[model samples]
Target: MPPQLVLASGGGWGAAPKMENGQPVPGEFVVPNGVPVGSVAYFQVGNPNPSYVITTVTWDGGTDIKGYMSGTPTSAPAKKQEVLTGVAKNQTSYTFVVKAEAKNYTVRADVQYANGAKGWVTVEFASVRPTTTLAVPEDKVGFQATGDTNTHNVAGLVQAIFFQATATTHQHGGSFIFMQLVKSARVESAYFENNKLVKEYIENDRSIPNGEDFDGKLHDDFLNRLAYLHIYDGNIMYGWHLMPGRSMPVPAAPPGGTPDPPMMFDDPKSQVPLDWIGNAFTSSFSTYLMYKPQSGVWVALNQIDWSVSQAATRTGPGGTWEALTLPAPTQVSQPSTPNGMAAFPTWVNFTSNFINDQLNPWRPLD
Candidate 1:
C-alpha cells in the first residue's frame, strides 16, 4: 500500500479521523465543528513506505491559508495558495494556519520513492465560521447554562382565554444546567466498589477560569444564537477560574463536626468516596413560561429533572448520569425565572432569570 494521510489534530475544531476495514483513514472531509478563523489544522503522514519520501507539500482553495512545518514558516505569509517544496528530509507532519471563509481548503503532498515511483495524496479541510471566544465565567460553583423557546400556539389560545401576556412570557422552552458544586469534582475512568471513582489523578480542573466572553458582534450572535447548543456541549466551564485556592464552595460543617478531608492522589489503592458528586449535579429543565396553551388559561410550568453520573468529566459537561444509591429524580425548586417569578409569584425581580446569569449576560432564550 502507499503512504496514508490522516489528521493529527484539528485546532480543536472540525477535524474527524476514523478507521476503514480495520485500517486508519480520514473519513468525511466535512468539518462539522467548524474551524474558526486563525486556528491551526494539523495533519499527519501515516504508515509511509520506508523508501517513499515526501518531496513537496501544498495547501490551497480557501480565502486565506498559510503553511507551517514543525512551528516554522514554510510558505510566504498569508496567501491564497501555499506550497512547501524540496523538503530536506522526511516530514512526519504538516501544519496549516487557516482563516474563516465560505469555501473549502485542499492539502496535497507529492511523494517519491528511491526506486523511481511517484505518488500523491490529497485531503480537504472545509468550512469556516467567524471566530468567537467565550470567556468562561468564574464562579464558586461550576455551572454554565443556556436556554431557548418556541411559542407559536400562544396567539390562538389567548383569544379563547381572554387574557394578555408578554411576547416571551407565553413561550415554551427548556434549560440544561449542571453544577460541580463539590470540591475536587472528577470523573473516574471506571466504576468500582461502593460506587467509588477508579481514576485518582485529576485530568483537568474546572476551577480555573480562562478566555473571554463574546466581544465582537460575531461572538454576540454566537452567544445568543449560532453556538448556543455548542456551548452547552462544549464544556465551556472547564476553562472557568475559581477564587484563589478554592475549587468550589464547601458547605458549612455541622457544629463540632470536622469538614471532609481533601481528595488525595498519593494513595492509588484508596478508593475515592462518591461524596464528591454533590446535589443537583446536572439538570435538564423543561420550562413553560406560560404553559397549558390548549386550555387558553396559561400557568407557569418550571419542571426541572436532575441526575448525577460518573461520565460528568471536566472536559464534557451535559449528559445522562447514573442514579447509584440516590433517588432517580430528585425534586428541587425552580430558581428565579427569566420573567421574575419567585416561588411561582413575584411582583419585582428580573436579574437572576438565567441559569448562568452569574457568569454570562447573554441568555439563550433572548
Candidate 2:
C-alpha cells in the first residue's frame, strides 16, 4: 500500500509516498516567499497514517533548519515534521527586494509526516539617519591716537612738533591735536631813562633810536594769548619749553649752577629785532587727548611737560611757571585775553596754518 501525506502548521515536509499506479502522491512542504533583513522564519508538517514509518524528508533548496523528527505514525495526529528554518541577512530598506529565486532562509521544526501540508513567512527593514556639529572664530581689539598739546611752534615750518599715533590692537580713524608754547620777546627797556638828563643821553644815542623802548605788558600779553588759546582748545596744555627728539631722560643742569638762559639778540642792523634764541631753549611738551564718539567721553591719557634745564627752576611770579585753566568748550569760540596786548587771537592763525602745511604729513605708525 502507498503511504499518505501530512502537512504541518509552521513550515515542514512529509515523507515521500509510494506510487499507486504511475503517479506519486504529493506531500506537505513549507517554503519561505520573502523575508526582511535581520529576522528569522520557520515551517513544519505532520503525518496521519499509522501503517507507514517515515524514513527521510528533504527540501528542494538548501535551507537552514533548527530541529526535526522521523518515526512510525502511531498517533492519529502525529507530531509535525520540519522542513527548514532560515535567518535573513542584514540590509537597508532600499536594498531589500522580493524575488522568485530562493536566497537566505530559516526553519523551526524539521521532520517527515504522513499527511501533506506546507507554509511560508516574510519580514521588512528600515533605514537610519546621520549625525553632525559647527564652529566659529574669535574677535580682536582696536586702538588709535587722538590729541596732543605741543604743535603750535612747528606751525608753517617744514618739520615741526606733530601728534603721532600707533595701532596697538586694531584699525580705526580720527584726528589728534598737538599744542605748544612759543616764546617771543621784544625790547622792554634798553636803559632806564626816566630823568631829563637820562632822556637827553638816550635821545643822543643813535643805537637807542626807538619810540617806547619795550613794554613788559606787551610780552605778558603775548604769552597770555598763547596760554589762553591752548586752554580753550581743550586739546592742548601749557608747557615752558619744547621737548627735543621726544628724547628719554631729558637733559638737566645742576642745582643753582647759573644755568644758561635763553639767548637774546639786539642787532640794530637786523630787520627782525629782539630775537629770543637758543637751541637749548627750543623744546616741546606732549599730552594725549582722545574722543570716543560711542561713549561721548573725552579721555586724557598720560600728560608730560618736557623741558631741558641744568636744574629745575622755581615757580616765580610773572614767569612761565604759572598754570592757566582751560576755558569751557562753549567759551572756546570767543576767548578774552587776560593781559592787554593784541585784542585778536594770534595762536589760532598759527595753529591753522601749521596744520595745513607742516603737520598735514603727520601720520600714525603701524
Top of the candidates by lDDT: 1
Q: Give the TM-score of candidate 2.
A: 0.17
lDDT of each: 0.28, 0.21
Q: Tens digits of per-residue lDDT for model 2 on 1-366?
A: 222323212111112332447674343222322231111122223333564344433432222322221111111111111222343321111111111122443222323333443322222111100010000101101111123332222111112112222111111111112223222221111112243111110011111123322111111122223221122122333222212122111235565343222111110110111221111112122222221111111112212222221111112212222112121111111111111111111121222212221222322211
Tens-digit lDDT track for model 1 on 249-332?
A: 123456644332121000001122233321112222221222211111112322221222222222121222332332122222
When summed lDDT is taken over every stretch of 10 residues in candidate 2, the lowest stretch is 128-137
Residue 284 alpha-carbon offset, candidate 2, angstroms: 7.6
Go through the candidates in order and give the C-alpha RMSD of each one to the true structure: 25.6, 43.2
Ten contiguous residues minimizing lDDT sum, candidate 1: 155-164
The clash number for model 1 is: 6
